[model samples]
Target: MHPCLEQADILELIFKEIYYRPTGSHTEKDLLALALTCQRFKEPALDTLWDTQLTFGPLIKTLGISDAEKESENDAFDRDVRVILTNDSYEPSPEALRRFSSYARRIRRISHVPDARSSILEEMNTELAVLVKLSSWVRSETPGPMFPNLQHLGFIGTLSWTSIPCLIILLESKITTFSMYWGNLDPKESEVLIGLLGRLGLSIEFLELTPLSYIRTPIDPNKPSIFSEMPFPITLSWIIPLLKELRSLSCGSISLNQLALQNLASRCTFYKLQSANTSDDLLEAISDPTADILSPFATLQHLELFEDNFRDFIKLVDYMQPLALQTLILHHTAPPTASTLADLLHSFSEGQHIASLRQFSIKHTVSEFETINSVNMDIVFDGLTLSPLLSFPNLLIVEIDTPCGFDLRDADIRAMAKAWPQLRRLQLGSKIGWGLPPSVTLVGISELLIHCPRLEDFVVPFGARTDPPPITNSTPIKKNMTYLYVGNGRAPGDGSEQMALARFLKHVFPDLCGVGGEWMYEYGLEEEQLDWAAVISLIKTQC
Candidate 1:
């Protein structure tokens, strides 16, 4: 035997290098050949090959066929290629189980998402039944879990009473990360799913559950939907005790009510929480006269709430202070009232989150239910509306994407740039409004680059009407900036305006690569888009 083969670590490293290569590299065939070479190479080679299993088909085939099943001519190759399960009740003998255990123990990750493009799991229809029988046999013979070293498990399919047990069996204390996506289910099935996850306890750390919806009946415009995105209410309230060590959680459309928020804050040490729909439960709870003032989300660092109108957010800041909160993202479903917007912005200072907060994003767009004109007339974010955030020293990224007009002037842009010298990305609005002219101009952008040298990706709406200031010897050349989004800013189609603006950008933003804007054809502004494209071309050639 080679001396390198005697050292298990060195041999494993060589096998891993081959295994981690890109697909269609023939790493599997080569590893199988090395496993059949000698006893020394077999264990390490097989270990590398079985580290990650995309499907349970390979494990099911390890049980072998029954006596009633007839073997085909290409049965050996067929078995190697796909799972051939003739009998779900085929009991694997002690010797067969020993073979299965060798490979099963080597598995570290199993992600069996059904109907995944170009995956073996697409063929897994009735084959999961064999796993139930196999798990039972393994438990009876072996003292520990089947996949002892398995740390990550993901399943994206239907979860019934029978399949829930399969998942429960898979959930050992060693697993840390889990992801599951399932279609609509009844309340009972949801209970079973929650119960299954409850077993993980403190062992699990990262959890993401996306509840997919499927409609069986036709839509009726007259009546309201019983199934509003999420079919059944799946709360994380009961599972709070189990997920004490959870660091990140994403509950798609599954709301975390006020009590759940309190429990999570008091019990769990999670830092990140995201929900598609943040209901008014928190607001209602805090407003209750009988409710006691308790500290909520003490350890939370990142929070993203979708489909909210800042009413709950306003109440949250009023009730509790986010001592450790860093990132706050609010995607409003409805246009925020001027008072609500002012209150929400000013609450950051009251909460003492000015120093800790780094990234702040507030986004809202006009839907079919509302028009651009309504959004424009309702609220216009100006210097005063955004002035409260000027105290955040460590703020790196600020994105306020409203599809309406912004009333921010040149002074406001310069004030922001001067406030956060460490600013990297400053995105203002979507630039989709009409008839409302922009207040900030090209000179404001020049001043922004001068103050914030670290600013890279900048998106803002500014009037391209006035000519930019002439470049001088003392002008600060911002070489770090690469992309600038012109939003809904219209540019002059005249050659003189385009050349001068292009020249100014080239002198100030030396590293500027591309200039982008919103789709102009939707608003019949093809000439405006063409003018910006001309600026990009001039920046490259004029320099």
Candidate 2:
């Protein structure tokens, strides 16, 4: 006989690990198999199985609706739909309904993509698209929410209107996180959405909104920008006040109502906030120090800005004097010269922003970073070295990408290591384009292992001129390094100096596998899609 399996927590963890794999045929099959196993694995297995639901169609299918056959029929409405998502006139099998309830409540997150490929409400037709309203119309309905315990909700639909009712139905008290991407919606529909969010009140912690396109056509901006033409019909004031306690917010691709946003920024308490990458309006508002706008980001600990230009960055940070900010993320931007860098550091230090900030990140554009090009450190690097940054008591992470126009090199690297010796994860350079010539060489990078003994991840550019200074270290400098990526493109494409550089890394950072910079762009991948950590492992095994 099999030994009695009493470790329920261990069983749950095992199921969770299995479900972490890519969501495909294998994951579904494995989860189904575990659920069908002994009753001990039922709850945890099911919870893991339903953690990230791509569609609610499966739950409807569990009601025994022959979805395939129904789709084949020409009729827009499916007969089996009423059997489960019924109105006043219909009834469902108690056993089937109970089974549906069991799984629905188990779901903690749901991505209800009920489009043509996974249509549930579409089967009910447009009139019944608002399931809650339809249930009221019929005078009879299910006893519980469609997702009673669902804390996170993400909806993907062809049109903005398609997800509005779906969002409304699931915008219950239990849901704290909501993300949606839809195509279109009218002003009336937009109003309904704003009303629905009020229901969530203080319970909502994370809200992501993406509009497929602007509800109103934007006039040529040669003259003026006005709120009446704002893409979203709903005012930001109405939405932000509702989620006053929001800790994290991502307003995706939606140009917010400026007036409403101004009011919200002045009053709302956001710890971490990110705006879309489309425009500079929001960024402009954040740093605007006009008396009309009180910097509402008084409690913000993290602020992320996605910039496509270089000059705007100077403006964006110039006015952002935060009180509690710790982590700042700047993505996809051009590099700054040593003088410009000094000016920025001085601004933060003089403003007292660096006093509380522990992390400063300037994600530089590819190949354009320049540091060695400067003739004097006293003039260029002085402000950087002498600024408040060197004194940041709590500073732990200093990551800067290769500057867009600056030729970053050895001296710059050494200056950074000397300033922030407490850094544990020090990464510099990018995987793709930066116009400036590479300047960082082995001479400076070697100092990192010597100074920052706790450094765990070191990524730097082995530019065309980079070469390891003569070193015969018998052992690793600081064995704590967990990840390393050196831009080993300095040697000719025929692979001459790469071997020596590889050897240098192998000796210095014992855990390093190989250099990486070309593979990602060659295959066309975004930062999120590329798994550099896994690539490190693969390169290590190959080496």
lDDT per prediction? 0.67, 0.54
lDDT of candidate 2 over 222-337, digit per residue (tens): 32223343344343345675676576776543345555455456755667666533226656565456626666566777766555554565565555555557887665534455
Across residues 354-450, which tens digit of lDDT does each residue of candidate 1 receive? Answer: 8888999877632334433233555666778788889888899998866655788899999999998889988887645322577788778878877
Candidate 1 residue 172 Cα shift, in angstroms, is: 3.1
Tell me how candidate 2 scores on lDDT.
Answer: 0.54
Q: Which pairs of residues collide in model 1?
A: none
Please give each candidate's TM-score: 0.67, 0.60
Prediction 2 TM-score vs. true: 0.60
Model 1 spans with C-alpha error above 4 angstroms: 1-143, 150-170, 180-192, 200-202, 210-235, 241-244, 268-270, 276-280, 286-293, 306-312, 365-375, 431-435, 453-456, 468-484, 499-515, 536-543
